[model samples]
Structures are given as C-alpha cells and as structure tokens.
Target: MIGEMKAQQEEIELLLSAFDRLVEIPDEERVVFRTLIERKTIPAQSHFVLIGEPTADIGFCLSGLFRLYYTTPDGIEYNKNFCGKNEFIAAYSSLLMKEPAYFSIQALMDSELLVVPFRNFETLFDRHACWEKLGRKIAEGMFISKERRERELLMLSAEERYRLFLGRYQHLENRIPQYQIAAYLGITPVALSRIRRRLT
Candidate 1:
C-alpha cells in the first residue's frame, strides 16, 4: 500500500513538472489541480476513448503510447495522430461541443495517464489567468498540429511524408508497428517497405 502511494506521489510530481514547463502555477492552484487528477492505466490494445462515446477528460500520458484513429463505415481505420509519454490526448472537439467523439484513442502499449476532467480545468480558467493561458497555449498547439498535418497530406509526397515522420517520431519507430506507421502515412504497408529500402 505504501509503495503504491509513493508511486502515485511520484507520478503527481511528474505531472506538476510537465505543467511547470508550460506555465507556472501558484501553489494553491497547483493543489487544486492536483485534486482534480486521477491516475489511470490503459492496457495494450484497449481504448481510452471510443467513437461515438462522450469523453469528459483530457489525459496526460505519463508512460506508453496511444493512437487516435477514425473508422470508416466499412470498418477501415485511418490513423489520425499518435500520442506518447509526456503528451496530452483528448477528443477536443467533442469535449468542447459536448458531443460524442468522432475518433477513438487506443493504447498501443500499456500506458499510464494523469487524467483530469475538462470541466475541472474550465473551472480553474475562471479562477486564474495562468490556467487560462495554459488552456490557450494548448489549443494553439493543437491547431498548429492540425494545420501541419493537413499541409503534409496535401502538399507532400508519400516519401517526403515518410521522411518527416522519421524525423518527428524516430524514437517510436521500433515501438510502433510498421503497418500502423504506413496507415499514418496514408500508404500501403508494401509501399512503406519500398520507401524504407529506397532510404537505406
């Protein structure tokens, strides 16, 4: 029991450190934020959020990997994004609109997350300017990421996208399956293999 408590404490410290990197939080505000957090573990191949389900929390990945994907009517899945340790994941549009999520978030590996209700954060936004700034920054970052992804898909060649993917997710290459990477690049697994050969 003591060991579990100590581990939870360590995770909380890590969460605080991550927040500190983004924006400074006053001790009182930090305490309030801490109270809002819940530690969650998602096993490999399990989902944190599913399509058409309401998601009320935003998760900070403490460890492990996740993929956000959308499925077609025929059940084909298209990879939209990947989240790794120290990253945040949420169905932002769904949360903001108070609707069911359009995409699903699945754990690619056993993952631990620091979860907080979006509503809790919304409350904090009214209490402090720092929280508001943090929220704004997070939103801006998401917007930039979305814009970049769209540009890459529209303007870049498959080979070029593969190169960019390597540069951006080099550490995750071995950890993620090649088929998923191919899906993320919007290419067939065979094409991805050819690209790898051409690069080598």
Candidate 2:
C-alpha cells in the first residue's frame, strides 16, 4: 500500500511538472490539483468516453495511446485525433455544451491516465487566476489543432496529408495500425499503401 501511494505521488508530480511547463502552478494549487486527480488504467481497445454518453472527466495521458473518433449510423468509424503520453484528451464539445458526446475516445494501447472531473477544474478556475489562464491556453491550443485539421482535410491532397501525418506522428506510426492512420488521413488503407509505395 505504501509503494502504491509513493507511485501515485510520483505520477502527480509528473503531471504537475507538465502543467508547470504551460503555466506556473504554485505549490498550494498543486496540492489542490493533486487532490482532484484519480489515476485510471484503461485497457487496450477500451473507451474513456463513449458516443451518446455525457463526458464528465478530462484525462491526461500518462502512458500509451488513444484515438478520438466518430461513428456513422451505418457503423463506419472515422478517426478525428490521437492522444499520446503527456497530452490531454476529452470530449470537449460535450463538456462545453453540456450534451452527450458525439464521439468516443478509445485506448489504442493499455493506458494510464490522470483523470480529473471537469467540474473540479471549473472550480479551480474560480479560485485562481493561474487556473483561468491555464484553461484559456488549453482551449486555444485545442482550437488551433481543430482548425489545422479542418484545413488539412479541406485543402490538402491525400498524399500531402499523408506526408504531414508522417511528420506529425512519426513516433506513432509503428505503434498504430495502418488502417487507423489511413482513417485519420481521410483515406483507405489501400490508398495509404499506394502512397507509401510511391514515397519509397
């Protein structure tokens, strides 16, 4: 039990360090943040959030990978984004609108996450200016990522997008399935294969 507690403390410190990189989190605030966190392990292929469910927590990936995707009525799934270690994942739209999530966040690998209720963060925002700034910065980053993704989908060729994907997720290529990569690039696996052959 002591060992487990020590491990959890280390994880909280790592999360606080990551947050410190974005904005200074004072020691007192860090303590409060620590109190809000719950360590969770999601098995590979399991979901952190499911479509049509209200999302209540935001997760910071401690290890492993996750994919955020939307499924069509006919049962086709499209990858919207991937979250890797040291990154945040959440059903942002659902949290913002107080509605059920339109998509799901699934673990691509057995994953460890530092989870916190979104309401807890909101409470912190009211307590400290630093928390408010952190929230704003995080939102801004999410918006920029969304806009860039939209632009890539609208203006770039599949081949061009594939190149960009290779650059952005070079570390993840071997870790993820080709079919999912193709999904993210808005192409089929066959198309991705052709593109890869052409590149080589």
Candidate 3:
C-alpha cells in the first residue's frame, strides 16, 4: 500500500529525471509522455535488442545494468558499452534507419526499464518543438560518446584503456562480472586479473 506507492513515486521521479537530461519537459507534455511510456522488468541475461532484429523500443534504465555487444560469425562476443541506471539504451542506428540491429543489448542483472515504442517516440519529433530539440540533443550526445570511445580504443594502451573504463564506469565494476569487463576492455580474463593486480 504505502510502500508500493512510494516505490511508484520513486520510479516516476527517475523517469522524469532521465527525460530532463535530453530537454526540459513542459508540464503538459510530461503528462502525455508518461502516459505513453511503459514499464518492463527484464530478468538477468535477457535481451533488450537482438542482432539482426529490428529494435522497436528505446528504453531508459530504471535499475540494473545492460551490456551492448556484438558477436562475430565465429561467435566471439565483444562488448561495446554498458548502460546503467538512468541512462538511455537503444540500438539507435537500427531505430533511426528501421533496419535490423548489428549489436545486441542484454541485461547483466534483473533490470527495470521505461520504454517507448520507436514509432510513437518518433511522432513526437514532428508534433512538438521540445521533442524535436530533444531528439537532436540525443543524437549529438551519441555522436560525441562514439567519437570519444573511438579515440580511446585506437590510442590508449590496454592498461590505460582499463583505467579509462574504470573512470567512465566504476559504478558498474562491482555490479557486473569481471569477464564482461575484460571483454569490454578487449582483454583476456587472465590479462584483466594482471591489470587489476598492478593497479592495486
């Protein structure tokens, strides 16, 4: 009763905060956006997006962690990024182009997400100026993040990259498995162990 109401209130606040990261949502539009968004809980190891499948929804993480990864034909998996609480998660390339995703997104823990269907979300771009600005801001943020990651991958040493990873995602270090962290660092588990030993 009271506990459930408090939990719901907390989740609503989190959702609003995430939306505000893109643009300030007007009171009237906020109500409409909240009405359209849906809440989903994904169990550990389940996927939010799958390789070769169209991404129909974009989600904001309410709680828990997700890994965005790509698999080669040989079945080797490489983690591209992790999305944690309050961050947006989407196969954006696929979402924008209406094509199958090249990467997959999976929860590393039981996670709650606030999701909006891409079709419904896209309609807001044309319907409202605020949403249009929000869309552009999201795009610019993604591009900047991508470029920063690219530079780090190309120029940083393995140890340096590990340090950068720690700086960027230290909050996730204890929450997810070491092997996934190793994969994101493009290092073997044994190598990651050595790096950890050296850092400590």
Candidate 4:
C-alpha cells in the first residue's frame, strides 16, 4: 500500500538488462533512462505485500527468498510460489488490474530488491518502447513458469514431486528446512522423510 521506494536514479540501465538483452535502447536514451531506478529491501518473515493490499510496485530480487501464499478457512497455509535471486516478485493479476491483491507475499529470508512503482512503470512504458518490451517479457516468463508448475502438480506423484523439487531448486532444498519443503509439496514431514529414505 506504500509507494515509499524512490528510484536510485543510477541503476536503470543495468536493471533493464536483467529482463532482456536491451540492445534496442539507444545509448543516448539509455543514459536518460538510467535515472529512474529504485532499490527496496524486505526482511525475513515480513510481509512484502499482503492479501487485499494495493499493488503498486514491481520488484526484482537482488537476493533472498519470498513466497506467495493464501490462508484457508481452517487457517492452514498453502504456498503457491517460491522465488529468489534475479526473479521478479509481484502479484501480477492485481498489478495489471490495479486492484487489491489476493495472495500475500512473505519473505522466507532477508531480501534485497530493486523496484519500480506503477506510476513510474506506466510513465516509462508510455515514453520508452524498450521498457515496454522488458515488461512484456517479464510477464510472459512468469506465465510460462506457472503453466509448467500446474502440469507438474497434475501429473507428478508426491515422491516424484519431492524429487522434482530437488532437481528444480537445488539451492533452495539445501538452504531451507525439510518442514518448509513438505509444506510446499503438500505433504507431511514424515512422508517427506520416507521419500528421502527411499532415495538414499
């Protein structure tokens, strides 16, 4: 709900390339555009954004972990996302519609982020075609990953899910705890242990 982040005014060109090759931005235009970036950092177990909260900023992680989750009537948590370095983190649906969000983002580890607000995003996109391309590519990438996860969930067994989890996020499995992995996989910790034992 807060648009407190101010563009660093120095890192835009470098950040832009994180989304795409950015060979299209003319040198003169790029020098001008570089003045519009800002950095944001969110701490562990903290809310980067909450359910029903306004979505204003689009953020890219410089480091650390965050998850998107929703609570059920019985107060159980279901994590729908896991993201870290170089990843873009935002409630895309809410950001696109300029509405309140449905999912809550909580940092699993201390995080440093780079962000551009909706106002700046709109102004930049309208004025610079290069920024628009970067935005479009980020959205497309997120869509592809979401679809892939949906297929994996529908087709894979629980044990297979655990194996795939390891294969996909090798860095995360070793860093986070087993219980968190179980929660992400929709399994009990005991079952996860059994799966691990079988693998060994």
Candidate 5:
C-alpha cells in the first residue's frame, strides 16, 4: 500500500470511504489495493473512453463529474448516467469482458481518477469474496436506476419532473441547460420553458 497516495487524498477521504463500502474492504485493504492503481486527471469535454472501443480498465472519480452517454443515428447524445465525484465510473461489462464498450464516458467537469486494468483488478477482486459484492452492488444499482428513469419518463408530468429535478439538483438547474433537462425528462424544450415559467 502506498501511504503517500493516501496522505495526498486527504480532501477526498469521504470518497474513498464510500468506495470502501461498495468494495466491502477496509481502508487498509483498499490502500493496498490502490497501491497498484494508476492516477490520472482529464479536463471537461474529453472522452474518457468511446463506444465500441476496447476497455481494459475501471476508474473511480476522486473529484469532479463524468457523463456516460451514447449518440443516436442522428448524432444526438443522450446521457446514460452522470458519475459524480467519489463514484465509480466504468464500462463494467466491457472492461470485465475485455471487449468493446457500448457507451462513452466523458468528463463533465475537471476530473481526477484512479484507474486499474482488468487483470490487476481481477487478481485482487477474485482473491476476496467481499470484492465480488462490489460487482453485485453495481449491477443492482443499474437496475434500480433504470426503473427510476422509466418511472419518471412515463409517469411524471413535465412540471413535476422539473420540480423533482430541482429538488435533487438545485444548482444543476443552472449548470445544466434547459434542453438537456428536457431531454432527460422526455419533454420538449418548449414544455420545459413553460414549466420554468410556472415555477418562477
């Protein structure tokens, strides 16, 4: 374990703690696991990995945000998920399979990350039963998240969706464009404008 790296991330300790729970490892074990990790940072708008590209690594954010999105035939990008600071962000299926990714991961903010290749990760994770729990957690989370998105799209009114969005991401209302919110909520931008007007 690299003690120096741990010392350097004093500001993002909470992030590490959250990951520790997901991976079901103690801080000490995590540090040992992290000793072999590679560190990197990228600016916003940079693609971390692109669709159909081979992915061998998994990454976790220490700070900043990430967007995992895919483009349609018409070249429209619908965000699949936003990986926030401290969260794990990886094309897990591809990385684990050593195959091409289905979606692209991009930095939405200036980002810092810890990366580990599939081989190294497999070595550590396969050795610990607890590490397998992380994979289950990720899978289960993806399922629940899909359900929530479906419910919001099919059930919520445009205004209600806008309100829910503001409740969860108050500042993001400004950081994110109204059009993007409209796309996420499956509404027209004009409808979003009306919702915003009603709120104000």
Candidate 6:
C-alpha cells in the first residue's frame, strides 16, 4: 500500500514537472489540478482515441509512446505524429469543439498517462488567470509544432525529412517501427530502406 502511494506520488510529480516546462503552477493550483486529474494505464496496441469518437480527456504521457494517425475510408493509414514521455497528447480539435475526433491516438507500448477531463480543465481557464495563460501557451506550442512540421513536409525532400526526424527524435529510432517512421516521412518502407542504405 505504501509503495503504491509512493508510485502515485512519483507519477504526479513527473506530470507536474512536465507542466512546469510550459507554466509555473502554484502549490494551491497544483493541488487542485492533481485532484482533477487521474492516472490511466494503456496497454500496448490500445487505442486511446478512435476515429469519430468524442475526446473527453486530454492525456499527459508519463511513460511510453503514442502515435496519432488517420485512416482513410479506403483503409490507408498515415501516421500524423508521435508523442512520447513528458508530452501532452490529445485530439485537440475534438476536445475544443466537442466533436468526433478525426485521428486516433494509439499506444505504441504499455503506457501510463495523467489525464484530465476537458470539462474540468476548461473551467479552470475562466476561474484563474494562470490557467488561462497556460491554455494559451499550450495552444501556441501546438500551433508552432504544427507549422514547423508543415514547412518541413512541404519543402524538405524525403531523405531530408528522414534526416530531420533522426536529428529531432534519435531516441525514438529503435522504439518505433520503421514503417511508422516511413509513413510519417511520407515515404514507402522500401524507399526508406534505400535512403538508409544511401546514408550508410
């Protein structure tokens, strides 16, 4: 029982540290947020968010990896993004608009997440200036990440995209599958193998 409590405290502190990277949470607010948040365990290959499902909670990954992907009606899947430890993952559009999610969030491995219900979190934006500031900062961060990815995809060659992915997420090279990386780079697996051979 004591060990379980300690583990829970550690998870809370880990998530708090991640939030600190974006905004400083006062002790009182931290306590409140902790109360509002819950810990969830996702097994490998489990889908956190499914296409056409409403996103009710935003997750802060404490451990493991998650991939955001979309599948066409024809069953073609494309990996849009990957979120690893200490990062936030959500179907932002669906969360904000309370609509069906366009993409799915899937666990690449067994993962632990700190999750907060959007309704509870959004209410804090009106209740506290700091929360409002945090929300804006989060949105700005997301926008900047999206814009940078768009530019890279538009201007960079397939090989260049692969190189950029390596430079940015070298740690993930072994953790994620090559096919997913190829999909993210907008290239086929065979093409990715050729690029790797050329670089080597």
Model 1 lDDT tens row, 46-149: 99999999899999999999999989999888899999998989999899899999999999999999999999889998899999999887888888999999
For candidate 6, write residues 1-200 as lDDT tens digits. Answer: 99988898898899888778878888888888878988899999998899998789989898899999989899878888899988988998888888999999999999999899999999888766888888888788888888998898899999999999999889999988899999898889999999999999
Q: In model 4, what is the error at residue 9, expressed in angstroms?
A: 8.0
Q: Check candidate 2 and list the clashing pairs.
A: none
Pairs with backbone N, CA or C atoms under 3 Å apart (clashes), candidate 3? none
- Taking the tens digit of each residue's C-alpha lDDT, what string does model 2 give over 69-103? 99999998899999999998999878978899999
The pairs that clash in candidate 4 are 7-37, 7-38, 8-37, 8-38
Q: What residue pairs are clashing in model 1?
A: none
Pairs that collide in candidate 5 are none
What is the lDDT for 166 in model 2?
Answer: 85
Across 1-200, the per-residue lDDT of candidate 5 in tens digits comes to: 68966655663455457666676576566666656677778798787889988877777787777777777878877667677666777887777667898889988778888776767767766667766776678768777876887788689887887788788667666766677677666667898888888878
Query: How do the residues 112-172 of candidate 4 rate in per-residue lDDT, one tens digit apiece?
Result: 8877776777777777787788777778888998898788778889889888888888789
State TM-scores per candidate: 0.96, 0.97, 0.92, 0.86, 0.82, 0.96
lDDT of each: 0.92, 0.92, 0.87, 0.78, 0.74, 0.89
Candidate 3 lDDT over residue span 49-163, tens digit each: 9999878998889889999999999998889989988888899989899999999999999999988898998888776788889878877888888898789889888899999
Off by over 4 Å in 5: 1-15, 23-28
Whole-model lDDT for model 1 versus the true structure?
0.92
At residue 115, candidate 2 shows an lDDT of 94
What lDDT is obtained when candidate 2 is compared to the true structure? 0.92
